[model samples]
Target chain A: MAFEVKDVLIVLPAFNEQASIVHTLNDIDKNVPGANKLVVDDGSTDKTADYARQAGAQVAQLPFNIGVGGAMRFGFRHASRNGYKVVIQLDADGQHDPAYIPELLRNLDQSDLVIGARFAGEGDYEVHGPRKWAMGLLSTVISRSANSKLTDTTSGFRASGPRAIELFAKDYPAEYLGDTVESLVIALKSGLTVSQVPVAMRKRIGGQPSQNAWQSAVFLFRAATALIIAYMRPTDPANEPHGEKS
Target chain B: MTYFIGPILSIALIAIIVTQLMRKRLRERHALWWAIGAITTLFLSIFPGILLNLSSWLGFVAPLNLVLILGLALMLLVNLQHSAELTDLENKVRTLAEEIAELKLEDSIGKVNVSDFPESN
Candidate 1:
């Protein structure tokens, strides 16, 4: 698929990333050039929305923090409405290196969804403590479910094709599990082909991750349970009120 | 005694819920469910034998245990219902926020193309 600025929309769901959003937006403009850019400022109390607006990306200012899933949903909706064929999800924190965006989009030729998996080939990302263990457990569960080799179940850097975009725009997990693990599960179950590309992520350029070590531990447990429940839920077209739009 | 304590507590609970419902502080749908709960507790408290008999049929040996377990189960269901309602409200708030943001952008950019959307609060 040829990457066109008008045809591709890179959605960065940001929360309190005022310091990093401008840099992230700049990277997209510099790296991808023609891809339309959008920032879903997930109800940041900080000036994240303002900074993104100033940076010239179309901004969707969420009144409050609605988590990544809700923000991604809005992103896909904007893509479908504005006639973009490819939508890429990036992090506002600048961890997701925009340098690999071309490779991710290229892989979209073989897959409906392309995720920038952190540990796929291992460049330099390190994980230890309870966090490492949680990722390992999640990787195992998600890989087993998706029936594909996936190294990073939590990587937010991803690309979506038209089919994946419209499905998510109607309904995506709006909370903790929706952003990562369950999203892939829902996509795979809904008949969208998913693949992962090896990408080395950079460290955060601004604000801390949404959760600390302790909160992540709690989140890990909750995410595991939600993933189990989500598996039982088959993505039925009848379940959604909206129908048939790409 | 069960007479003075249980009935009075149930009546008091029902009265509070009823007043809230009448004042429109609580939704009628939710209040109706709570009213059923208050009335069930009142009935079970009045005729403890009904619970004891039902518990025995369900293979429970202790009536108090049955009462407490049932009460806990009902409370859990109510909590689950609240969670569902909360999730719905969260989605609504998000949609409203995004819609307003889009409108603000259109207004500032002088596009004025969003007249189709109903004005949202």
Candidate 2:
């Protein structure tokens, strides 16, 4: 079926997800037919690029592991440069469902960013203890920055309009936890309209999940620091098409 | 006269800096600044009268005290300068890396056809 959004690219950013790369690509192909799919293999030590290529998705092999921020930036650059009108990012570990791509694209008409939030009162997103507290704190901070309530600030499943594509293609955050926190901060601060929709997410069917509890705390601290910098530092006024909302 | 202490400390420090420079561990650009620092300290230590006159002009208590204070301040300035340069270089390197990574991705994924690029239209 031909999509209403003609120039839409499904971007799957993967790193060492050899076990589920093919499966992820298959889901995109089955769900979103006639869509240009690009798998950004972020310097995976395994044969992720080869598997993704065999699975019939265009493969962009990074020279080294540049983290999710770098990989996503690469995908965005490819989409922006290629004249793709919209880009929907999906995680490679089968955790992100491809069914919500249409909803995200449709919402892109009004907002520059449409996030597929798992905890948007639609599904069960379980967390406990300090991690839950951290998520709540992050959600509050991101909501204020975005000028809209965002339940899942860390959700990788999101879509971007031309303005966001242009911004990210030029410069995106490349830090430990900068992908989600710093990128959102830039989008909101640059006066881009940001919104979220409820979407159910799946548990990782395969592949190793990076980050331990200790590492997660460190990442939280780093992401929080990046958020502060994004707020404090003055961005180029000309780059921001929509004037500062705050 | 604070003679033995000054020469001994500065000489040891200068010796290490020079050795590092010779070994290519320190770049010529940074070596020049360290060399200047070493010479300034050595000159001030050897000539107490010069420091005495300089301190009197600056309204410091004594040349012996001024030498330490001035040297410390100069070193701090040098460190600050190095830090600024390092930060500039780091930013440049990071930008270059991201660009290279983007270009490499384009190459491996699909070489962008300039004619197909939307900007041309």
Interface RMSD of each: 1.6, 2.6
Clashing pairs in 1: A5-A34, A5-A35
lDDT for predicted candidate 1 compared with the true structure? 0.82
Model 2 CA lDDT for position A28:
82
Candidate 2 regions exceeding 4 Å error are A1-5, A209-216, A243-246, B1-29, B48-121
User: What is the overall TM-score of model 1 with all chains considered together?
Assistant: 0.84
- Candidate 1: list runs displaced more than 4 Å: A145-147, A209-220, A238-246, B1-16, B41-70, B113-121
DockQ of candidate model 2: 0.33
Alpha-carbon TM-score of each model against the true structure: 0.84, 0.79
Q: Highest DockQ: which candidate? A: 1
lDDT of 1 by residue, B20-57 (tens): 98899999878767888899999988888898789999
lDDT of each residue in A1-246, candidate 2, tens digit only = 122556888888888888998998898878877788888877789988889889988887766776788778877888887898788899999998888888888888889999999888866767665556667778899898777889888889999888888888876766655778778888887778899989987889786565567766765676567667877877767567556424
Q: Is the docking of candidate 1 incorrect, acceptable, medium or high quality?
A: medium
Error of 1 at A110 (Å): 1.1
Cα distance off (Å), candidate 1, residue A140 = 3.2
